[model samples]
Target: MIEMTKRIRDLEVSEHLRTLTHERFGTRGRFTLLERASGIGASKWKNFYYKKQEATTEMIAFWIEKYPEDESFLMTGKIPPRKDGYPFGTIPPHVRQTETISDRLNWVIVEWTSPRGAALFEYLEERSKHQIAAEEWKKTVLGEQAPTAAMVEIVCKARPYFAAWITCGSEIDSYDQVDPTCTRSIKTWRSNLLKQLMSAPSEDPEK
Candidate 1:
């Protein structure tokens, strides 16, 4: 009976620690950040979270010292006093907003793949009157490297509709309004890339 009670208490404490950790580092928090902050290796942190091993006194002390404001809640699961209109250990709104933008940009560059991209490549080759091999185009769309400025300009001129979606993130209603400046053009391209990513179907066709 005593052993069972001890197991239950340990489980509760583990859960509380996990909750505190998650709250401190939003949903996207990584173990590497914890490793840096607490001086605990990722493997050990993972083991504690998975309940493969208990959190030692030294580890808990390190966490408390690192996040002194959270010590009360970390030890007793009690809510701490709010500071500057934000709760203790919660990520700030501006920081969360920045992370969201980064996530969208990363998704567009890394995760999103579409037939529209392939079509854009075909259009570029035909308009340039130069044969761009399939493998080369694949690398550009996958963001393995950036597409050349000449290629971007040619594509924008040849297929405004596709290029608008690819470069501006939405259909460019008026090409006349598009600034001819190099900086604006690059920004439009990146913005359109993110916009196109948002419109792409998320469900995996293979699944």
Candidate 2:
């Protein structure tokens, strides 16, 4: 099963919404229908739908809520209904994705940190530390001390505020963060877990 937040990176939000509206109501929908159904402003959605602007996480949530069952389809253009029991945004322990793991980590960290009221300056500060810690982690792991699952779990659970920052949006490439600075930290953290996982005698598909 795919992570709830993972979706087709190139799929435009407006296009997905259009298809969802068509499927959910059993008819092709127009702007007025979309606006009323999703409770979104026409101008704003039109801007995104027409490619004048990209839809942010906030706008996409409205459309997703309308056809929650098709969330997987909306995310990947795949036919599988995302009617899995798990709720949106929470990582299911049973699904393992080497690819989506990084973004999931970012989502966990950001959500746990400034669950709300995150300011630009706050992000700027935390992002820098996250980068530096990652670089040092690389150096450490390259030696005799590879990362342990315990080490990764601590950071993932504790939700350290300093050292990483990424905003939510459809611009997420391959479920990786599009930090104007970079998605390197996500990759680096992924690397930390991958080293340990790959070295294990047996693999845990459920991880």
Candidate 3:
């Protein structure tokens, strides 16, 4: 049996993300509270954790709220939702005019006739552009694109924020996997695949 431990690693911190996270949650609780608020568990939390040089914006927001001086910061100012608008907006500009974040984050499946010849694709399609100068949004990969049908199945099992992009050159099927509560199928892969890198979550899938 696998032995689970309660030794939650204290989340990391950095200045750049610190400013961003504080701006995201409008709070000082950091990941400790952000995790609870987001309902994302430790396994999924790693995506926002760890870094030698820079802290993730999500982690920074979590840290500020968790710090002792949290109330002081809270009392002084309110952090606003990103200018792009989380939970209520669309990514600015666009390439795939017909696609949307809402479209990406739903249940979808695609079939490839020639398993050997086709590229069974899966991805998290986000739309993003810099707030300052960029006026258009672009599609970007969330995790690795599943290379084969079997890989697609494994990826589906992982419950990643992904969608099948192409069954073959003839067809491209895409959709998001809703409700990311169950990581049973892809838990191990998530650990191996996601390297605790920095992410902005600024891009909107529904652009």
List, residue by residue over 172-194, the lDDT tens digit for candidate 2.
33322222223453454455546
lDDT of 3 by residue, 1-207 (tens): 123221111222233344544443333333443455444554344344334334334544554544323323333344333332122122211223214432233222211111110111112111111221111111111112223333334434543444332221112222232212223323433443344333435668899
Give the alpha carbon lDDT tens digit for every residue of 1-207 in model 1: 999988776676667777766644334334654675567897887788777987677767876664455666776778655434221123222221223322222223221222233453454466567656544554554335556655556555544433433354432444332222233543565566667789898998899
Per-prediction CA RMSD (Å) = 15.5, 17.5, 21.0
Q: By TM-score, highest first, what's the ranking?
A: 1, 2, 3
Best by the lDDT measure: 1
Q: How do all models score by TM-score?
A: 0.36, 0.30, 0.18
Clashing pairs in 1: 167-188, 167-189, 168-192, 169-192
Assess candidate 1 and give its TM-score to the true structure: 0.36
- After superposition, the stretches of candidate 1 with alpha carbons farther than 4 Å from their true spots are 1-8, 27-29, 81-207
Error of 2 at 112 (Å): 44
Q: What is the descending lDDT order?
A: 1, 2, 3
